[model samples]
Every structure is written in structure tokens, then in C-alpha cells.
Target: MADILFQHEPLIRLGAFAGAFAAMALWELASPRRRQAIGRSVRWPGNLGVVVLDSLLVRLLFPTAAVGVALLAERHDWGLFAALSAPTWLAVVASVILLDLAIYLQHVMFHAVPALWRLHRMHHADLEFDTTTGVRFHPVEILLSMLLKLAAVAALGAPPVAVLVFEVVLNASSLFNHGNVRIPAGLDRALRWLVVTPDMHRVHHSVVPRETNSNFGFNLPWWDRLFGTYRAQPEAGHDAMTIGIEQFRDPRELRLDRMLLQPWRSDAGRYPIGRREPGG
Candidate 1:
């Protein structure tokens, strides 16, 4: 079992990249704001490399933990392994939905918890919110998040099939939600009912603190709706809202070295000293 998983790791990783890349390419073609993103030379490699490294690191560090957890707590038992023979598509969809739900909780915690915010802020450090921006998380944040997700997978009893499917859905959605794409107004409104539409997600990455806090769900729109955290698109919405945390305004702050060392910098006197209240 472990051997099969290890052998397929590259293929699985590539599959995720393919999905994300397709969405990003399509979104770039459709969205007038493509230029707003950091641009391909920086965008493509940076986003791709970071996601791969982070995911691979997570997998290597926790070898089979996800699979083990899934096996032990799985509610349904088809056999000793519970190797259910459902269609792959079903497994994929189930996995995506479950993983996304877990992510929503983690995202909320990052904003609400002060210590987590210190690490998660690096994600918000981007001066822009584009497809590539979605993958620009701090390594520490990624590690911490993977640990939380390991627990979630165990609790949810997610199968390998589900994990595979979730990886694809996650990659694709992150690209779509973060891509500077503008879906047709009518289509976008309707789609947000089932999935996280770009319009809805754009609000989450808004420079305005109020806008930043809404729409944290990564895949479906259900959690945001159910939790009373949902925000509708602004009637007279600006196509471009400011992006990034105010504290990371300096040009040098974009550097990886600076980003890694950011928390240690005693800029406690900084205007946005810490995360201000959502609307602050």
C-alpha cells in the first residue's frame, strides 16, 4: 500500500499542477486583470514550486499518517481495508468537499488566533492576490496547517481516493478563486451557490480589512453561508481592490529572507502593529 502511494506521488503531484495550471491559464485569458498578477516569470514557478515543496514536505514528514488515520477511523467497512469500490469520481468529490471544509476552519482560526496570525500573515503579505498568490504561504504556516489537516483527515476518515480527488479540487479552486478572472456576472452569481466563485473570493483578499475577513471557504460556498460569514458582491464593486497586509508595504518585505524573518523584526510600532479588527 505504501509503495503504491510512493510510486504515484509524482503523478499525483503533477495531476494537481495540471488542474491548477489549466484554471490559471484560462482565467488569465478571460480576466482583464491578468496584468495585475506578479506575471509568469515570477508567478508560475513560484506558485508551482512552493506548492510542490510544501506538499511533498508534508507527505515525507508524516509518511502514511493520512492513510493510517483514514483506515483506523473510517466509518464504513467494505473489508479489512474497507477498499470500497465506488467510482473514482465520487471519491474525488467527497474528498474535495471534506478537505475544503477542514480548510475553512483552519483559515478562520488563523484570523481569530493571534499566534497563528503571526505565521499566517505571510500569506497576506502579498501586494497582490492572483493565482500564484494562493500558493505563497510561509513554510511554517504550511507545516502547521498540514498537522491540523492530518487530524482532520483522521476525524473525517478520508480515504486515499478522497485525498487524491481533494488535491485536484483544491489546486483547481485555489487557481480559480485567486486568478484575476472575471466570470460573466450572471454565471458568477449562480455558481457561487455551489462553489467558491471568484467574485466572492475576491472579497476575501481585499485590502480593506472588512473585505478580507469574508468568504474563507476554499472549495464550496456552503460553510460561509452556514456560518453567517458570507458576503455578497458589492453593488458598485471596484474591479480592483487593494491587496496585501498593510504592514508588509515595504518593497523589501517581498523578499523570502525578509518574509522568513518578519516576525522577529521588532516593528511593534508599525501602524497596523498587529491584525486590527476585521474592519479596522
Candidate 2:
């Protein structure tokens, strides 16, 4: 099963991405949670452009990605799980859990660190929250994230199957949780306990820094709850609260060129921790 999954990794990833994206997009059109702050024409192209670029660059730089690294580790008897002689199922489970935790922590660091936040803020700068917004990370940030995932896989000795499952699930979850579609309140309440739902993640995109800093988990909700960063809802209420950072509200900023240039632009004091107060 693992060998088959690994052999067809690219096809699996592409299919999952396409299916999830189409589902969320159709759901948004059917019953959008919020009126789009920017039209799909303006936002979708740029957001999509970044993901394309990131995918190309990552394939060029790390041909194998994290899954390949895991396979390599297994062959050489490298990494923690391999070294510990863990069972296959145990290693896979532990790998997924640990990888999710690592991502949660990495998200916190991106918001907390000034330099990294410059790259990461491009994601938060989307004038709206939707499925496309989930994929709108800067290429540099995406590259750095891939590097981090590779390192984590190496250290954990994660199974190749675990890495594939983690990647696919994380990708699908990002699209699902960042969607602008609405879920019934009762269902949302129960669903969020098991996974990070759209409502849960929307809080993290709130324009207010405090709300933006909360609910950083992409796949699992437990990390935020465990770390005391889980905010139930935006203080101003989800419908009334603004999305995007305070700094870049202009529609032109939503263009692919401007997004590519975001990291080098002035700080805008958009970062959450130890803010320097915009030219202070």
C-alpha cells in the first residue's frame, strides 16, 4: 500500500487538490459565509499564481520532498523512529501527530518573528478569506516551510506513507478550513472538536492582531486548545469583523506582482509580537 501510494504521489496530490478546491469553490458560490471583499477574478489568479510558482520551485530544489526523505531514512536506518525500532503503524501515527504539532509551532513562529512574518504576512494580506486564500502563501515562505518539513521528517524518521498522508490531509484541510462556505452552527460546534473548521481558522485571519495570533492550527484543533491559543470566535463577531491585515487594503496590492514584492516592502507594523509600531 505504501509503495503504491509513493509511486503515485504526484497524481494523488493533484487529484486531491483539484477535488478539494473545486468542492470548496462550488460551496462558496452556493452559500458563501461572507460577501467577497475582492472578486474572484482579482484574487484567484494571484493566489493561484503563488502556489504554482511555489510548487515548481520546490520540485526544482527538493526533487523528493519530505516523503522521499522519509523513504531514504528508512533505507539507511536513520531518524528517531527508525532508530527506536518502532512498529510500522506506531511510527506512522506518531509521525502524523508530531508533524501536525511541528506545523502549529512553525505557524506561531511565522507570526512571532519579524523577518519571517514579512513573508508570511502575504498570506494574511488577502483582502478576503476563502479557499484560494488558503493557498496564497509567498513563494519564499513556501520554500522555507518545505525545508522545515524535510528537516522534521528526517528527525522523526517518519514513514513514507505517513508523510504522504500528512501532506495530502494538510493540503485538503487548509482548503476546507479556509473556505468561505458556511456550516450549520451545531455541526460546526461538533466538527471543530475533531478538526480545524472554517470558523475556527477565520479567527486567525481577523484584522485585529490578537485574534490573528490565535487559532494557528491548520489540520488539528487540539494544538491551539492545548496551547491556550484557541479563540472561539472573533470578538467583533465573524460577520462584522474585517479580514486581512490593517496595512494593505488596496485592491492593487492583491495583484501577483505586488504580492511577490511584499516581503521587501515596509513592515506596516502588521506583525503580532513585539511590534515596532510602524516606523517607531
Candidate 3:
């Protein structure tokens, strides 16, 4: 199973991404939670473009990717799982959970660190929030995130299957939780306990600085509650709350070239967690 997965990792990931994206796009069209001021024509092109660029860069720079690193670690008896002589099932489950936690921490770090926020803020700069917003990360941030995930996979001695599962699930979950589609309030409340719901994750994109800092988890909802970064809803309410950062309010910033240039265009602004004024 592992060998087969390793050989076909790209196909598996692409298939999952396409299926999830299509599903969410349809769902959004059918039951959108909020009216979009800016249509997909204005945002999807740049957002999708970023996905293409990020994919090509990752494949070109780290051809083997995380699953390959995991296989190498297992062969060399490297990292925690190898040292503990853990059972395969336990390693897989624990590795998936730990990897999610690592990603959660990385998200928070991106907001808290000034320099890192410059790269990550591009994702938050989308004037509208939707499924495409989920995958709209700057290339530099994507590369840095891949490096972090690679290090975590090797250090944990994660199984190749587990790494593959985590990667696919993370991609799918990002699309799901970032969708503009609505869920019934009762259902959304219950779903938040198990997975990050769209409503829960939307608060992270709120224009308000503090709201933007909360609910950083992309795959799991627990880390936010565990760390007290969870915000139930935007202060203005989801329908009324504004999306995107203050710096790039112009629609032109939604273009691919402007997005690529955002990190160099200005000061980190008031959004970086470290830059927030005391009691403001």
C-alpha cells in the first residue's frame, strides 16, 4: 500500500484537490452563506494561479515531497516513532494528529512574527472569502511551509501513508472550512466540535486585527480552543463583517502580480500580532 501510494502521490493529491474544489464550488453556488461583493471572475484567477505556481515550485524544488521523506525516515529508523518501536496503527494516528498540531502552531507563528506575516498576509488579503481563498497562499509562504512539514515528517518518523493522508485531508479540509456555503446553525455548532466549520474559520479572515488572529487551525478545531485563540464569531457577525486586511483594500491587489508583490509593498501594518498596540 505504501509503495503504491508513494509511486502515485501526485495523482492522488491532485484527484482529491480537484474533487473537493469542485464539490465546494457547487455547494457555494447552491447555498452561499454570504453575498459576494466581488465575483469569482475577480478572485478565482489569481487564487487559482497561486495554486499552480505553488505546485510547480514544490515539485521542482522538493520532488520527493513529504511522503518520500517519511519513507526515508522509516528506512533509516529515524525519529520518535522509530525509537519508540510503536505499532503501525498508533504511529499513523499519532502522526496525523501531531502533524495537524504542527500546522496549527505554524499558522499562529506566521501571524505573530512580523517578517513571516508579510508572506502569510497575502492569503488574508483576498477581498472575498471562498473556496479559492483557502488555497491562495504566497509562493514563499508555501515553500517555507513545505520545509516545515518535511522537517516534522522526518523528525516524527511518520509513515508514508500517514503523510499522504494528512496532506490530502489538509487540502480538502482547507477548501471545506473556507467555503462560503452556509450550514444550518445547529449543524454548524455540532460540526465545530469535530472539524473546523466554515463559520468558525471565517472569523480568522475578519478585517479586525484581533479576529484575524483567532481560529488558526485549517484541519482540526481543537488547537484553537486548546490555545484560547478561538473566537466564536466576528464582532460584526459573519454577514456584516468585512474580509481582507486594511492595507490592500483595492480590488487591484487581487491580481496575481500585485499579490506576488504584496510582501515588498509596505510595512507589515497593524495586523502582525507583534505590532498591535497595547489596549488598542
Best by TM-score: 3
Better of 2 and 3 by TM-score: 3
If scored against the real structure, what TM-score would every candidate get?
Answer: 0.79, 0.96, 0.99
lDDT of 3 by residue, 1-280 (tens): 7778999999999999999999999999999999999999999999999999999999999999999999999889999999999999999999999999999999999999989999999999999999999999999999999999999999999999999999999999999999999999999999999999999999999989999999999988999999999999999999999999989999999999999999998988888885655587
- In model 1, the clashing pairs are none
lDDT per residue, candidate 1, 74-163, as tens digits?
545432223655454565566667678889988988876666777777767677667777777777888888788777766555666566
Worst 10 residues of 2 by lDDT: 270-279
lDDT of 2 by residue, 78-126 (tens): 8999889999999999999999999999999998988999999999999
Indicate the residue-level lDDT of 238 in model 3.
94
Compared to the true structure, candidate 1 yields what TM-score? 0.79
Which ranges of candidate 3 are over 4 A from the true structure?
Answer: 277-279
Poorest 10 consecutive residues of model 1 by lDDT? 266-275
Would you give me the overall lDDT of model 3? 0.95
